[model samples]
Target chain A: MAKTLTQEFTKGLWEEIAPFRLVLGLCPVLGVTTTVENGIGMGLATTFVLVFSNLLVASLRNIIPSKVRIACFIIIIATFVVVTELLMQAFAYTLFLKLGVFIPLIVVNCIVLGRAEAFASKNSITLSIADGLGIGIGFTLSLAALGSLRELFGANNLTIWTTPTSVIGVQEVFGPHFQPFSFMVQAPGAFVCLGLMLCIMNLLGSK
Target chain B: MRELIKMVIVLTVLAVLSGGLLSGFRNATAARIEVQQLKFVKGPAITAILKGVSNDPIEDRFAIKDGETERKVFVGKFDDKANTVVLESFGKGYGGDIGLMVAINMEDDTIVGAAVTTHSETPGLGARAKGDPGFVSQFKSLSINDSFKVTADGGRVNAMSGATITSRAVCAAATEAGGIYQRMKPQLIEKLKEFNK
Candidate 1:
């Protein structure tokens, strides 16, 4: 039986939520969320990669040999990542530098491949698109949530928009003295933020 | 036989698709990637020093000399009034090279400002290099005559509680970069005129 479209669109929120429930793509979810800007850049870049890879993979799912499907998934995801990385460089160069290796690392994010293997292959093109969208949004939201907490607690203020200084007035509140959270921006803080967020998510889900 | 033929065709198609995609992406984003690398790593340092100049820093190329060691400086720009040159410098820290961009002012031959690009110092210890702008801000308004050394080293720079090594490395790089730019001052002015013209 053909499943309803709603299921496809809603699967990523609670069921596959990338980092929390599915436990996939946690590396990036934890690694990049030091501040709001880093988290947003990382999330958007991942979403771009995820959406494009899913679309292409589902379209070519049947043609891809089962034995070489993993290879194909990697290529498709890498292509999208490169494209997104370039776009970020051209337009938002500063944010792009801040994100660093994580942009390329998106190729290995399990969420992209997981969707291709679990859902895209079985679904229609439109449904696959929906699934990709849902999952991408979920991942981005998770990153931003983690980033906001880190930025607020780690730093005095949050810097979401990554311009030089002329963003929706982040400088006004934070001013020049506003310092970033040294630990939160580093590797250790990634685990802490994700762990705490995951706990809270679990608690909220139970309630 | 038919299945074998189909599998070969599929594999061939995948290879062609991947190759085609990778080549296109590499070509399209190569320049952009280069620019981004310049902006983040070196851009802020230029801004910190050239705060008053109407024009953007000269982000073409330059050089930094440390003792006998010389490294090519890229994405560099020059300002005419201050007769300064901003270049990328890598200071040796506990973990690795601490990347910084320093502005050399020509008037008094002082370092105007420096913006750190990257570092791997221990958190709350060496990482204070970034967290404490005081560590970085000290670079502004200081001249070569002042001696860019930490207070412990008989200079004005104040080392952080835990990041004595990193602070010293930064001071060393800033000092070296300032020395090199002073020698290159005449050429820098000529180059700035050439670039602007």
Candidate 2:
């Protein structure tokens, strides 16, 4: 069945959210989500890349030969990733420093490649853009949710954003008496947190 | 035969276009990126090393051509006289290169302060060189001409516990800064004169 434009856009939010539903692009989901600020910054950078790459891939889908399409998609995706890196370095240097290698790794993000190959290349430009925005926003929300869960338990604070001069966030939600579970911010913590979120997602979906 | 030619042509065009576009964007953002780095990465280190100075070291900076490389030299004004200059040098660390910013008092040719600007050393171990002030504070008041070495290598500086390699790397960077200062003393003095006016 041919779906309407709104359906195409809304499907990514819940039905095919990258991290939870589709479970694609888990590297940044786990790696950079140690803090809420890092998660949002990383997500926005990835979204910028996704939207542009989808737009280009869909536009050039006809011109791109089948045999070399993957290579073409990569070239397109890589260009946007570098653009993101450079812009982040110029404007958001602090976030750029935090994101570091993960910025460039967006080129290899399966969500980007998978979308370009499966949806963008075959779909119309408007539909491709809708899909890209939907999936990208979904990915960002997932990272933020997971980041808040980990940071709340691990550090006893929620950092919304960090400017050069001041940090904008709640300093201590649990108050002074609460001792933070430091393990929730570490590598193993990421895995456990992700698993629990997945379980919760599955339980909700089962209904 | 036609299909093969089409593939080659399509790939070549896409690669060339992507390269041209990225290179253009990189050139446009290069200057802004440098300013951002100075502000976020190197600025704090310079300020910490040149503390109590009457002027901002980051703003009162000049570049000197040392051999083939042009090095940035930040000037600090003390009591209405610009007598100290900070130079950055890098040494190989456990994981990668560690950048050390060394400040020298031109009047006495002695070290003012040294701080790590950028590094990729192991967290809690080698990274203590930057995170902890105890290690770098020892570089103060030493003659800029002297070569630095850790206690394990028969020198006065003590290596951080469990981070001997990082300590040595910092020592090497300080030594390098000393060499650069000695080599460029005359030019640096002239540059400081420009800032005084």
Candidate 3:
């Protein structure tokens, strides 16, 4: 029943990936994956909040009353979310604009609260940190994968990152002749893509 | 009993700590955030409206006191004369307030150009106000004193199809800009004189 630090971390990458495996925190996973840049930005923001909140909640687990634990967790989570929002606005203003409401909405991300409740509250600080990092990186990888898939088929471009002056990505990824499946970038496309990914994840796990 | 006291203490301490941390971070990052907003959000719109100006509209800016509120005005220099000013105003839209930056020529009192700075309107419909230039272009060369209204309200400007509210919000903002420009003209002239020399 005991998970070593390595196991705690690795599980998040595959066995308990937030979006694909655990199926938690789909709001951002579905919303901000329009571009790989967006996905990475959202994932990192969530990761920052997750790691800090987990650290704080685990450290304070002894002091937090069972009746008021959820409230305490939210306060800690919300503070970090705001910090992420401010930092993003100050530094990555364009990404901040693209992500918009989702950054503030990170406070309500089930993954953060879920980890705080189920894992961090009962684990050692080192274990909790490993879990946070593992899950955070897993979420980031999942988002980037989805974003690249969607961006490639939908926009026919893979926007890895956007700088103030230039975009660092492939243009006309399918050699300009291939028509973009524009639907893959729409709201409905997000659902279909996510569903297909979930199915593929299930198929891969079964073996 | 003791459990209730513990809950209160725990919740209070957590809440207070979170508040203090957030406020400190906010204070530290507030100035940088403003610069970022100017560079990304408001800068493009200001540049678009002040096209062909001899000076950087974003750099040559001044704040004017209107009653209690101080409004930042961007100055545009055309052919060596600082005769145009852009003022930002907001109009209530269906989703939220839409920010409009309206530029006015001081000599003729006509609108030079107008652009949307910030908005939260519905995409592809209300959001077209920012994306598509056709709707905002109607304000070009029009006198600032003229009351702006869409066809539905019996004004000259035509509203974008399926976005009447957003169009009206933009019109309202332009009209509000006129009011502010007129009210601040004397002080604006004084400020423009400083820029001219």
lDDT of each: 0.73, 0.93, 0.92
Q: For candidate 1, what is the DockQ-based docking class?
A: acceptable
Candidate 2, clashing residue pairs? none
Model 3 lDDT per residue over A100-186, tens place:
879989999999999999999998889999999999999999999999999989999989778799999899988979999999999
Show model 1 residue runs off by greater than 4 Å.
Answer: A169-189, B1-5, B29-38, B42-197
Q: Pairs clashing in candidate 3?
A: none
Task: Give the Cα error of residue B193 in candidate 3, in Å.
Answer: 1.3
**Would you estimate the TM-scores of all the predictions?**
0.63, 0.84, 0.87
Kindly list the per-residue Cα lDDT of model 1 for residues B87-196, writing each as its tens digit. 66668998788877776655566766777767767767887787577778888877754548889999888888778899998888787676666665566666656555
Candidate 2 per-residue lDDT over residues B3-116, each given as its tens digit: 999999999999999999999999999999989989988999898888899998888889999999999999999998999999999999998999999999999999999999
Sort all candidates by lDDT, best to worst. 2, 3, 1
| CAPRI-style grade of the A/B interface in model 2 | medium
Task: Please report the interface RMSD of model 3 to 1 decimal.
Answer: 0.5
Q: Comparing 1 and 2 by DockQ, which wins?
A: 2
Candidate 3 CAPRI grade: high
